[model samples]
Target chain A: MLSAEEWDILRLSLQVSMVAVLAVAPLAFACAWGLARGRHPLWVLLDGLVHLPLVLPPVVMGWLLLLAFGAQGPVGGWLAEHGISLMFRWTGAALASAVMALPLMVRAMRLSIEAVDPKLEAAARTLGAGPWQTFASISLPLAMPGVLAGMVLGFARSLGEFGATITFVSNIPGETQTLPLAIYAALQVPGQEQVVTRLALLSVALSLLALVASEVLNRRMGRSHVRD
Target chain B: MFEIDVTLRRGERTIALQCASAGGVVALCGRSGAGKTSVLDMVAGLVTPDEGRIVAAGHVLFDSAGGINLAPEQRRCGYVFQDKRLFPHKSVEANLLYGWRLIAPEQRWITPQEVYDLLGLAPLLHRRPVNLSGGEAQRVAIGRALLAGARFLLLDEPLSALDAPRRAEIMGLIERIRDSLGLPMLYVSHQRDEVERLAALVVEMD
Candidate 1:
């Protein structure tokens, strides 16, 4: 029951959030693993930086992203020299969403990694595994449930990301207008309440589906871990 | 042959131990907090000693004065933890083969079939660690260690967690492994009977 424009918004939202979660997963895993296991002195600082987006106003984060990744910004200028741009682009929206979702990803993953017994890792070491080998064989597999949960959480957060995305990419109808932005746009126009309702319902449905999927995945992983 | 002379300090506790083993099981008997496990951990390179030297299998595993400390994986010492510490995500067979896979082909003398037969693990090969009994888990842990090409084994109270019957069963299994493989072992325990039954050399600690 959605029009072509509404369909485009839904499709773009899905694409942007997917990209955001995918891009954030690996980095989040590395950070979580380090925070959970490493004894580096700078871990406190690193942790603070990772969680900054979670506590900061979304608009502030978006502004920081713009400053760092806008065309006139240092990093953005370097990227632009290589034929890349994030300013007011869908990629910029994805970047903002990813940033907003990262803390959840890292927190979930870190807790999971921490739950894995270090004694088991030591046991692996004594059984001929080096650091990397032990992590690959033991730590990573045991922490998989958390990593999956983190990804779903990140995806959900990305789906609802509005302030950072709007501030960074603005509201471009077919390019950067995600579901939330679309709903917001529909609200600004009087007598477009029907459009707003449909979009809002779609967002709720998408988020609920994600939460259900995460629960199913976590249960399956938990069962396998228990059986093993 | 194995030799260790180490001093470790953890908080206010200081554990200083000196012992040497020519062959057979060398039991480190001590009360809790007496550094029995700490000694084993030091030899396995899991815990670094403030000042010590550890030599095993004609190689210097650690020498604090000489600035030489081999990593745990480089020591070729199979350590069986008290809790078994079997990989929960892996099946019994996979856990048994965990260390064997890392050894160089020529160094891998213990075959999977031999391990399965020795530990009576064949029946439980496909089962996970969570499904196994305490005794079963320890047996798999032992098999995993032995197959890793360990020149010697460091067993930290491998039988402490089991009941009397299971303890006896594992003790019997340990006796068999000693007889069959003849690998030197450092067995940590506080039990007098275990020391009397299995150890050829006893290193008593306070």
Candidate 2:
């Protein structure tokens, strides 16, 4: 029931969101683990920085990202010299969305990591597992439910990201125009109300599906964790 | 011979313990909060003594004066906690093999099959720790430690969490393991009967 252009936008949205979630998951997990376990005094500062994106206005966050990652920016210039340019590209949209989704991912993962019993880690160490090995074998697997939930939340947030994506990478049709951008573009023109309505419905359905999937996965993990 | 003379100060209380064992089960028996667990933990390298020395199986595990403190993994002391603490996400086989895989093949004294047979764990190999009963879980924990090439085993009231029958069963199994493996062990318990039955040396603490 949709035109080829609409399909392109939808597909691009999925691609960008998936890439965003995948790209940021490892970094988010590391930050979460550090916040949950590390006793360093700097953890308070790190925690605030990680959650800044969640509280800041999306436009402000987008502007900050542009300042740090724009072609003229220091990091961006160095990366450009290496032939990797994120400016005004789909990769730029992914970067913005990844930043936006990072706080949600880290929060979910931190709570899960904290739930894992430290005594279990101690037992693993007694059994000859080193610190990294214990984390890989015990902490990571036990916190898998949280990790999965975080990933789903990140994916959903990335899918719905509009303000940051728009500011960082303008809504160029077939390039940066994702689901939310297309919906916004459709709203600006008269008699495109129907397009907007369909896209809105699709977004709600996708978000709902992600929430339901996360819930089901979390429940299963909880049951498996309950002792015999 | 195994020797431990450690001093740990926690707030207003200071626990000083000195004990030695000559190649058999040695029991640290005392009331709760008498630092029995602390002594075991210090030997396992989980808790560092403020000032003391610990020697087990000819290895100087800890010497505060000499500044030699080995990490828990490097200490090679298999600790069976009171709650078993078997990895919840891992299967029985994986839990048993968790440490076995880390040790060099030449250092491995006990094989996986030996552990499985010793603990009667053949049927529960594929089941997760969540699916195991308390007694079964303890057996798996013991089996896991044995396979890790433990030079010495530390059982920290491993049977306290079980029922009377299960406790007796595990006690008998512990005696069997001690006899068969000939590994020196430091058993921490408050139960008089448990110490009387299994320990060759009983170090009573207040």
What is the interface root-mean-square deviation of candidate 2? 1.4
Which window of 10 residues has the lowest lDDT sum in candidate 1 chain A? A219-228
**Docking quality class, candidate 2:** medium
Q: Please give the distance, in angstroms, between residue B134's alpha carbon in candidate 1 and its true position after superposition.
A: 1.3
Cα error of candidate 1 at position A85, Å: 1.0
Could you give the C-alpha RMSD of every candidate to the true structure, in order shown? Answer: 1.7, 1.5
DockQ of 1: 0.66
Candidate 1 per-residue C-alpha lDDT over A1-228 given as tens digits, one digit per residue, 9 for 90 to 100: 999989999999999999999998999999998899889889988999999999999999989888988888999999999999998889999999999999999998898888888888888888889999998989888889879988998999999999999999999998899999999998999999999999999999999998887777677666755532
| DockQ, candidate 2, vs. native dimer | 0.76
lDDT of each: 0.89, 0.89
TM-score of each: 0.96, 0.96
Model 2, A69-114: lDDT tens digits are 8888888889988999887889889999999999999998898888
Residues B112-135, candidate 1: write the lDDT tens digits: 899888889888999879989889
